[model samples]
Target: MDEALERDCVIAGGGPAGMVLGLILARAGLRVTVLEKHEDFLRDFRGDTVHPSTLTLLGELGLRERFLALPVTALSTLDGVIEGQRITLVDFGALPSPDDFLVMVPQWDFLNFLAREARRLPTFELRMGTEATGLLHEDEDRQPLEEKAWDVDAAVRGLRATSPSGVLEIRATLTVAADGRDSGLRRAAGLIPEESGVPIDVLWFSLPKPPDPTPPTLGHLSSAGMVLTIDRGDSCQSGLIIKKGEFTQMRRAGLDAFHARLTQAAPVLGPVVGTLTEWRQVKLLTVQMNRLPHWYRPGFIAIGDAAHAMSPMFGVGVNFAIQDAVALANAIVPDLRRGAAPVRTLARVQSRRERPVKVMQRIQGRGHRVIARSTTGRRVLPRPMVALIRLASPALRRVAAHVIGQGLFPEHVHTGSVTPRGGHGEVGGVPETWSKTRLWHNEGN
Candidate 1:
């Protein structure tokens, strides 16, 4: 197609990753456009917790105070439950940052904040209520097979539904897929993800704020699947973990039955459940965690849920998405300025994010196993196994601390300067080009 129709970058999906990336690129004076299918920013209970590592990134972007000033709840620490006892896991204070705690903000509000921020940048354009229908590609001049010649032209076409408009074809030097777990872009590109079996889904609901006598913070209830009570202070809401496909039955049983199940899980949550006036108020979400085989192909690159979708068990979805945005921004800025090869730039981003992504996957997988085992798996597993987890609550807390406080994905730690090296030659049996960057193995902050 016409080269004049293209832009510097086109982002699909206006979630945390897309918004942050648009802001970063626009600030750098690069032409960027974000296409979102949703017409508005209003969304229900999505991932709300922003971990410290993400907060640190916000600080680096000079947005810490602005972010913190938004309506949110500051959770100083996370508390886990095993066999009825509550154990404080991962004290945020231990982390070497002022914003150590997880900051809880409604997903809709946060996304709105990001969208508003993105609009302020002259180079950034947001096309809401529009969807990317297909991709367009331009053939690059072919080179020898061994020389790694690849297609250099691929752009996203967004169709707007509103009147006074025609098909808006946005060609970008690079296209980013931030479209989410069931990403149309990824599927359109025929990319498959490697799934890690972390088997736990969640049933989410928000009740009227419980009375002041109720608990002020969240806690996992050992008796009833994992319970998270988000006390807005005035009116609190609670979320309960349930088996996959259990939501339909719960909804069929009617609202009263669902409220009973929640109240039974945590009696202190009764006040919140009692005030539920409508069955439609409750929402159910199925959580899955998986990583793409490759984050990029040719002129396209995927980030956030498009690249990897993790369980909401640890509430790290938004945090990790924002982190991916930062990493992608950092990696691509130099390339955009230098007019580097598109494939090389995407490869650099994938390589830079590899270690952090693997680390997070492992952590999420472990957490899912623990929670699933504690709840539904208890019936199938031996009694000794259940007893062991209950007996080792302290160890579990320590593990949680390492995973949550230190960051399930520590991309921030990987952001320092790289040392210069000598001529291209074999070093320690590896090529000199590959050995230039040293991977730091610093464990435990």
Candidate 2:
């Protein structure tokens, strides 16, 4: 067996949740290692919408200016077209200044930015091309029943992962499962998320922008279906919603039928729809909503999509995952600083995050139902309901803006940086150039 490495915390997955958690904990003076299976975060069609709440977080971290320096598209209002009439759904302009608008940047750029800032901290290490294989555990501590009360017979000590240095064993005071919805570590810990049914899937593709400037409307709905468009300078990233399990039928219907559907929902894209002539340009996103009844077990816990998968509704998945990391760090940094395991405090992370996740998932589910029903009637709202909504549009827009922009129970960065730049650091590891290999250890952590 390889020599074991020790750290204060080891995070599986290097996505938004894992990276944010690693940065926060490392800033608080704990040695943190984050593992990413991908060599880099360059994948496309990923979530790129940055809500106002996350923008506010950047300011707290002293990274707002640095992040904004990158090329980004800012959106201040969310509008929707129903049956031929345009209606404003959300007006973020009513919120406080500076961060009232939504920022759109490529997901890869955002992840890479977080990683660079994290590596500046002396206690942080990011391992690219490393994948976590399973969890590590030890028998419960031998103490009086009252002194050593834990829910499980075994406590998760850390995890086993494949790194460039062959089989690596990481022993940490806390093990985090942030590897996303199909988390191997979460499954290794024997935790399963209860599925919340989602009835629609999204086909994401890009079309050329219309020659003339268009309204800042984001969503278009008709009896035919729903299409969401985000202006990306020269191109528009469009998502066409279809009932779940219907991709096969869509393929069989031919590309022309798909083009007709896109135009039917959002006529503004009619000129550029022909650019998506090939199926290869389109990507399918299977939406899911689910959460674990319990998020922690003994010395380990799950966060982000590993604990609860969010639907594509409102584009809040990335922001919510980030909030989860902030909450976890705030809840346990004190315990870690004292060299304690934080087993008892792990529950607090779950308790603080579970309600918001559940509430958002519920709201997304209702949205899915509305879309599913609207597809059959060609219009999302009836004439009478439209009149009522138009009359109350001002009040409704403010409420909608607050919900989408701020989210529920937003968290602030509570942990402070412990080490200055260059003061004692092993920032980034040597880049690894190793092939995939499997190695297992029968010994427990």
Candidate 3:
């Protein structure tokens, strides 16, 4: 068995959030170790769209060109189907930046890129096939006790992980729970999210590219409910926005029934469903948005999905996770450099990131209510009501821009700058690029 590994910071979970944090901290010369439970990044049907806001962050990190070079599709516009007709609700061209639209790239490729970049940094190390079981607390000696200070112990397994080589105790000045929604560290810390009362779940599926497609881009079909569709380059993917815990019963009804309902929900999806050959080809996933009351607990803190898991309504889940990473890194890097109090630094991070997350959760809640309304409510709504919503398309576009364009994290993430003195130095400036003009006017003034 190898001896205990010590670092300045230990990040649990190698998803986008943890990997990005590792990259930023390692570049800042902090001894950082990222523990990932997964042996490899080979998951299918995961989030694939990188929003303009995330693209902006990539630019600041000097990785924009590399990210764009991956096999991806750039969506130039946002389209929605209302009453069975396609309408261009938001034009990406109206957004002031050169990279206006979303870049569709696989989550694995994104994580692999981050992991590779992290590996290149001397101060960073990534341990895959490892699981963080519990947190180790510092004893009263003011020194991390051999076992106590090494509070976060992870089980490190080799490539062919059968029997664990040994317990890998990571002694660090601070620990980050980027381990995702079902976080062991969050549970260990006894922190739970204050539910936002948004109870929408999604079932995501991918199939062979539709034979014939119309109005391809980010789209939604609204009838009794909202069915979202996105072009996955070679394949056309769709998500059915339903109430929480609805997918299991649908799956149990068998693939034929599932496909029939999907085709029926959006007749335009018939082409996409025709290509499905086997039940194994379809993937189902559930999404919810939750935020913790407090993001920090003494020596440990939570970020990304661990801190706030938003609904997939806007397809901003990964973007938000990456933004959280940036915010967490920005908040803590200087403190780590100066050896500030772990508790104080974590508190500052939470305060900085909390409001933006709350705003996002509220927006997601509103979207859920819109999609999940009753059939009578949707059909009986007057023409004036329909016209009002259509008139508000620009505002909706702006909201989309803020959510997807700037990412769920605060503005400092893209600006590579922080607020000036006495003005909430921990907080980020509002996203200026996603301006109201671009949102309401549909033109870059």
Candidate 4:
């Protein structure tokens, strides 16, 4: 190895889970190093919905004020235009005071903000452009006392990563895999997820912003398919949900048919349909719903999409990943103070998260089944059902809002912090302008 380093904790994939975990751990005075393969968080089409649960977390961590300062759009309702009739699926406005809306910002902006805040902690180190290729192992002879007592044969030591300089071996007391669904470190640790088999995939692309200042509807559902749209100021971030493996058939039918499908789902986009002239402009998101039967093995643990890949049904993927981070941090911080967390301690993290993850997955699965039936002309929502929904809209909206926004067993930031930055602030107002979000570190001191 060209370079070798030791730390109390080392995390792979600086997405929401990894970044948040690193931040909380370092804030509590543990040395943490986060390895991110990408040089920057500028990628497009990532999950951008920062739900109420996460917004409340920002407040608990004293980051709400700073986060709200960013140019972000807040939506008080999750609505869908079904069969040309608008329906409010989830009413965020019915939630408790302050965090009664969902904030929508680019995923890159959120990640960048977390990274900047984490870097301010002296015990934290974020290495961009560093890719963790495999897990590091310790021989039985060199096993630590805790490993021997816990009966762990080959406890993971850290990771083998490749950076611009050269090969590097990181020796950490704990290693975390937060690299999303296709987590290489989790694979290297010989962990596998139980695939629940998702029935739909999403095609993400952009359309020119509409002239009307009113933000685009959250979702549009039709027999053709479902299209979710978000107004991103200059352009609209849109996704067309299709049956799994249907993209190939759509491509074979040619762009004209695809354009027809788009218009069928959301007529409001008909005017901008011509803007998407090439196939390259669209990105396919292969949706997967799965969770590792086990989230940890000795010193290594998988969190976020690495542990449980959530469906994008209600745009809850990002929030769940972040919740995993908070829950994991809360579970392991005390253990880290004593030394490396034991297998039992690691199991606590999974134990606390497993039920919530499974429940959400079940909910998403039911949603997919409905979408499947609807796309196949199965009359999933009869006229009577529509009337019933409208009748129960008030009560159903409150229930849906609580479930989707707060999530089941939402986590709080209990890991304590060294820096007394901004405390949890009220999440009431929207900025008049949203085009001024810059990296947190770039603002004037």
Clashing residue pairs, backbone N/CA/C < 3 A, model 3: 53-405, 136-151
Residue 383 lDDT in candidate 1: 54
What is candidate 2's lDDT per residue for 1-445, written digit by digit as tens?
4657888889999999999999878776687889999999998888888999998888877678888888888889888886667888889898898889898888899999999888777678898999998767675342322333334767777778887778777888899999999998887777889998888888999888876647866878768689999877667888998889889998999999999988888888888898887999999999888899888887789999999999988899999999999999888877776656666698888888888888888889988988886556556667888778777899999998899899898998866654435444322221211232111112211
Error of 2 at 24 (Å): 0.9
Which pairs of residues collide in candidate 2?
223-378
How do the candidates rank by lDDT, highest first?
Answer: 4, 2, 3, 1
lDDT of 3 by residue, 63-154 (tens): 68877888888887778776555566666665667768777787899899877655655567888887887666654332222333223332
Candidate 2: worst-modelled 10 consecutive residues by lDDT: 436-445
Which residue pairs clash within candidate 1?
A: 7-171, 209-235, 209-236, 210-236
TM-score of each: 0.80, 0.90, 0.82, 0.90
TM-score of 1: 0.80
TM-score of 4: 0.90
- Provide the overall lDDT of each model, using Cα atoms, as 2-decimal numbers: 0.66, 0.82, 0.68, 0.82
lDDT of 4 by residue, 92-133 (tens): 998897889999999999999998887776577888999998
- Candidate 1 lDDT over 248-367, as tens digits, reads 777789878877777666666776676766766767677778898788877688899999897776677787787788778777765664544367778787777666778777877776
